[model samples]
Target: MTEEKIEQGTCLRCGRVATLHRGLCIDCFRKSSEIFTIPDYIDLTVCRSCGAQLKGKHWEYGGELKDIIEDEIHSSLQELSGVEVSLEDIEMRRGGEGLYHVEVRAVALFPGGGVIPTRKALTVRVKSSLCPRCSRIHGSYYEAIIQVRGSGKDLLRQEEAVDRVLERVDQIARGDPMTFVTKLVKVRGGWDIYVGRNQSARRIAQEMHRLYGGDYKVSSKLVSRREGRELKRFTYLVRLPPWRRGDYLLKDGTPHRIEGFQGRRVKLKNIETRREESVEISSVETLAHYPSKEVEMEATVLYTSEREIVIMDPVSFAEVNIKKPPGWKRRESVKVVRVDGGIYLL
Candidate 1:
């Protein structure tokens, strides 16, 4: 909004006429820019647990190895103070047997409002170390121990479920920055899992409840007291259900299939009556031993009727007639088990 003031001059190197500073035009000045600078050698510290980098006095959690290396090199450089430089591209690769080449592309503003692109190189040197959290974990430092246990036949079942939960939690921990498992020890009845953090152990117990119905109890030990407050390490006792889903529990003269479990309650359905009942877990206990579902025999349907269905066991070549299972069909195979010296459909 003022008068147009055009200062015309000639470039020093190319002799072009335009707005000039220090006997040079904007284009020629930009071609001869010298603001970008970096050091020859840089040292970097990378965390193995979270892959974070320590920059000067602060730790940067969102930095990759290459990016941190470039930043360290840039920080050690002696460039014009109070000027902002933009990093365009950066790369690092091994050039020879013991040498690595680091190339950093950058752009800086010239005196006459021109952008100058400059590329620089530096040697890459790295030092790796564990952060505080990971170091604590490696030192067998844990806040809680999760004990998985079951009684009677459920002991084996609980072991399987614990293995599955450990596998799944380990998969999750590979990507989760907060979770880690220190060790898994096999005991007589079940397993004991040592966890690095309390939250991670709680999460594993929650997953056990979700995948397989169970209950957990937490107990804390007072290790030390500070200012009337106690510092404690915790232990979690996770008890799996006595009867899992689809498992048949022989109570009295009836074998009831377990539907699921509620809090302190066991849900069961009669295999023949199809009646459902929920009983308190304390009121019932599993039998000494029960035939496993894996050893069941295949039964082929030979005849079907509205009142009853006849099926032939291919293993023993015996035909057993029971009330038709819902959705019964002809010439179809069904898995059946031998219980109490009688054949039953499962």
Candidate 2:
């Protein structure tokens, strides 16, 4: 009889006829080998201002610290860089200042149909860094200063105009969170606003000029010299006209009502002659300012006709007859302004 040779290799676990790998059969090795790799420690950064977590180079808005810590622990674990990790349970608690300890229980599922239960204890380090917007605001930094003033404008009107301009500026700032204003100062004849970004200041100046019909001029002053170059700070001057629409001004003893601003010129209508003219605002002197409410008085209608409306001044009871403007309703009570030697119905 021929001598028989027996296969010698046996599985490490069951002693079966199987190829051995690292002293284990293929099946046993797949079941026993460690296929998961995770770090004992993880590190992440949080924004000091907005509670945003830094993921790579981007900011992730995380609502709470515990949620961020949990997410960090889950994302840091990997199953041999290819296996899928299914989390079973996670427990995290604060260890100390900016330190969190996490205990995780998960299952590693292999592509080759193997599953392993895993338990890991990880420590996370939380570092605080200012977010982009908060960093810009930390130093009270500004890129532009807008000086609002007029040559002969009324103080009250200029002040009110600044209020309107600030409202629009606030709207822009809300749209772009990076744009901000550091200070809004009440200056003579107008307001001076310090803005945080050049684009914000430019936007404000442009919108002011477009809506209110003004002009803006820009200038820069050398703030610092560095490395053979000068660092200059920008200033924007928004020049509003001296008069606004519906304002009454006395020019050369004549009452002229402001129509509106036309570029660098002011449009006005003579209250007495009923003639309209546009002129450089500086040529006229404002001997008197007539604000509508301050100048208006309650006048009772004494008589009404198609061509004329007669009114009795409540203060002096003087019967006054005036030609009515078109579309006058001839109400029993009317708003009228009397100054110097003239009376006009509003």
Candidate 3:
């Protein structure tokens, strides 16, 4: 005789109907066969809704309704102390339906202990903020619901944590030097130097003398300001010591280097090449009875005294006495021309 076939029923563990050949559903089978229950601490708090976790805020536990409270405590400790911590062990006492109880083990590194379990245990309460499965499917930005087991320990000591983090940050910032910006201008008798926008040319001249030591004169020129207003811009003329201009030095720290005079020989290259020549001076005695302008004239220095020099125009034999002020010397040469002015060899 042949036996009749019977319909299958749902498995009590997973609620899925069993197949004709199998007594339990696939989900129940997998759960029963797995050797380990809780894989890691992070996994224990997975939201039943979306299974998403929290980040940034230290100790923030993100996930299902069961883990919200623990995550908050974790986030708080992390912010107070610069350390990473994890839940080590968990004991689920009562679960399912509307209530649950759990004991969680936490481990973190401390200054005193290299790595150790926290002496204070954490008991959390589990509550449903969102549906475990639905919350996992769709997330909520408006509200956060969590099931806390019990109040957890304050992992970080308050004052010490704040000072330590601040000190470390300050040390890093102080390692670099500060920097600023300014403008540079070339003065009439001075080299280019830096100055602020509000600084005056006279102020810069004085500063240059203080820093480099030189005689400076300030000149003013009109410049256009905004909206067609005219404003005066001052320029400083510095009389640099001759030695400063050249590669020589004097006992009084003055520069004795003559710009146009290269030793005793007078370089007539520029004057001879020019078509027209004019002479300027402080006095007209050296240029008396001479023409106002001249063309094609040869110059020569005859004799030089402490304060004046005697020069004669080689072309016309015209003689002239050129005055040398206190700063002038006999070793200097003067250019003589038929013109009414004496052109000194700069």
Measured by TM-score, the strongest candidate is 1
lDDT of 2: 0.73
- Candidate 2 backbone collisions, by pair: 153-242
What lDDT tens digits, residue by residue, belong to model 3 across residues 233-255? 55444333222112211112221
Which residue window of length 10 is worst by lDDT in model 2? 1-10
Q: Rate the local accuracy (lDDT) of all candidates.
A: 0.70, 0.73, 0.35
lDDT leader: 2
Off by over 4 Å in 1: 1-12, 15-31, 35-44, 48-51, 55-64, 70-101, 105-118, 123-129, 151-159, 164-178, 206-211, 288-292, 295-297, 325-331, 335-337
Per-residue accuracy of model 2 over 1-346 as CA lDDT, tens digit each? 2322222367779777654544555467557865555688888889888787888887766358777766666666655543578888778888898888888788776544556677878888889899776787787777788888875536766777678767867787666756777778877666888777778788777777655555678998888899999877788888886556777887777678888775556788887678999986656643576765566677888888888989887666788888877788867888766766567776
- TM-scores, all candidates, are 0.71, 0.62, 0.20
- For model 3, what is the error of residue 280's alpha carbon versus the real structure, in angstroms, after optimal superposition? 23
State the RMSD for candidate 1. Answer: 5.7
Ranking by TM-score: 1, 2, 3
* CA deviation > 4 Å runs, candidate 3: 1-78, 81-112, 115-204, 211-214, 221-232, 243-346
Task: Give residue 29's error in model 1 in angstroms.
Answer: 5.6
Report RMSD for candidate 2. 9.9
What is the per-residue lDDT of model 1 for residues 104-156, given as tens digits with 9 covering 90 to 100?
88876544455667788888666677766577777887777888877656666
